[model samples]
Target: MDVVIAPDEQIGEIVADDIAALIAARPDAVLGLATGSSPLRIYDAVAERVARKQLSLARARGFMLDEYVGLPPGHPCRYSTVIDEDFVSRVDFAPGAVRGPDGDAADLTAACTDYEESIGEAGGVDLQILGIGTDGHIAFNEPGSSLASRTRVKTLTAQTRADNARFFGGDIDAVPRHCVTQGLGTIMDARRIVLVATGDAKAEAIAHLVEGPVSARWPATVLQHHRRVTVLVDDAAASRLELADYYRHAHAHRHLVS
Candidate 1:
């Protein structure tokens, strides 16, 4: 994975905006989207572009990475709510262009299969935006999750629930124990993937993911093996990275070449 250490959070947003622009230029772009505080700023940047009439989502499709099971579709914590509050309702994408696993499905396995099939029929994702959990998980694919998994339901670990508690009235117990997520195999199918992180809370995970060996224990580390992965980090998140200078130098070299 190539790393871009932005000077600050706003720079990171600009970097993310550029990535969105690149996706917009594709013939038929399918986007894999993540929701969390880490991605909010980038979403804001993209929304700004749309508001300014600098970009359009007319030809784009979005697929959410995961959704908390058992929540009503209108629940504030639902992925559908996030897409609506963050991007969908604000953008000009056509009806049905934004897709995700059904949180209230009576048969979750069937729901997952349907979600996977729809993504496949659409020709797979062109760009995926990700947010790394402090525990090194991506899209709720918790530690030790199988790399070849398909879309399915999984139990949320205590730490994950606690981490997400703030969104559920700051009560960890209120957070759903289960969520449906696209598998690692599915995520890796995207033509390009962007993982964004900020804050010192993510330092250890970032260090392990960028420098440590690829293992399911830290699912995001698998991106290190993918040729088209790009990791954007703020200074705090990059603090534990030993190869920070190497990344900066490489980015500088690329800038010069262009």
Candidate 2:
């Protein structure tokens, strides 16, 4: 994993630079999109690039990380809707180019299977954007999720519901109790992964994800096993990392070696 400690305002540009480069090389690159506060800046940066005519997502495709189960059609909180409001609508992605697992399908198992097949048929994701939960969960794959799991429905942990309550007007009861999410195994197949975190609230999770031993209890730690992963964090989020100085030194010298 390549750890990048950048200022909160600048991390988005750093990640966007990489994505822009990828899109330049592969105009039809498939992207794994994550919703929530962590990736808003990335989307904003990408949108800015499109406005400047420096980038275009006209032929790109996207797969969302997860979708809340039982949300009514057109519900603002639905992951699909959220993705559209947050990122897709602001860019140039072709119509119907983004897809997510069906959270309200009559046969959820079949939906999960189909979603995984769709990703495989698209030649897999070129890059996946990720955000870690305060409890270390990734894409609703809470603690104890199978390390090699695939796309599937998962019960939302109480803490997860509570954390997401803010999006539902601070009412925990309003949040969905289940979701369909891409599994760790599915995320691992992406050619590259970019995980972002910020603020003091994420410090502990960042510490475990970067320095702690790989364990199911902290699902983000699984990134340690991926062949290509980039972790971007602000100073506040990197507070708990014990090897902070070393990470800084390594990042500073990486350009020299390359």
The RMSD of every model to the true structure, in order and in angstroms, is 1.6, 0.9
lDDT value for candidate 2? 0.95
Candidate 1 accuracy as lDDT: 0.86
Q: Which stretches in model 1 have alpha-carbon errors above 4 Å?
A: 255-258
Please state the error at residue 84 of candidate 1 in Å: 1.1
Candidate 2, 100-145: lDDT as tens digits: 8899899999999999999999999999999999999999899999
Instruction: Write one digit per residue (lDDT tens) for candidate 1, span 1-258.
Output: 788888655654665576566766773588888888877777777777778877777778889999999999789989889878887887777888999899799999999999999999999988888999988999989999988888999999999999999988999988999999998888988898888899999999999899998899898888887879888888899999999999888877775434
Instruction: Write down the TM-score of every candidate.
Output: 0.95, 0.98
Q: Which pairs clash (backbone N, Cα, C closer than 3 Å) in model 2? A: none
Off by over 4 Å in 2: 256-258
Clashes of each: 0, 0
C-alpha lDDT (0 to 100) for residue 57 of candidate 1: 79
User: What lDDT does the true structure give each of the candidates?
Assistant: 0.86, 0.95
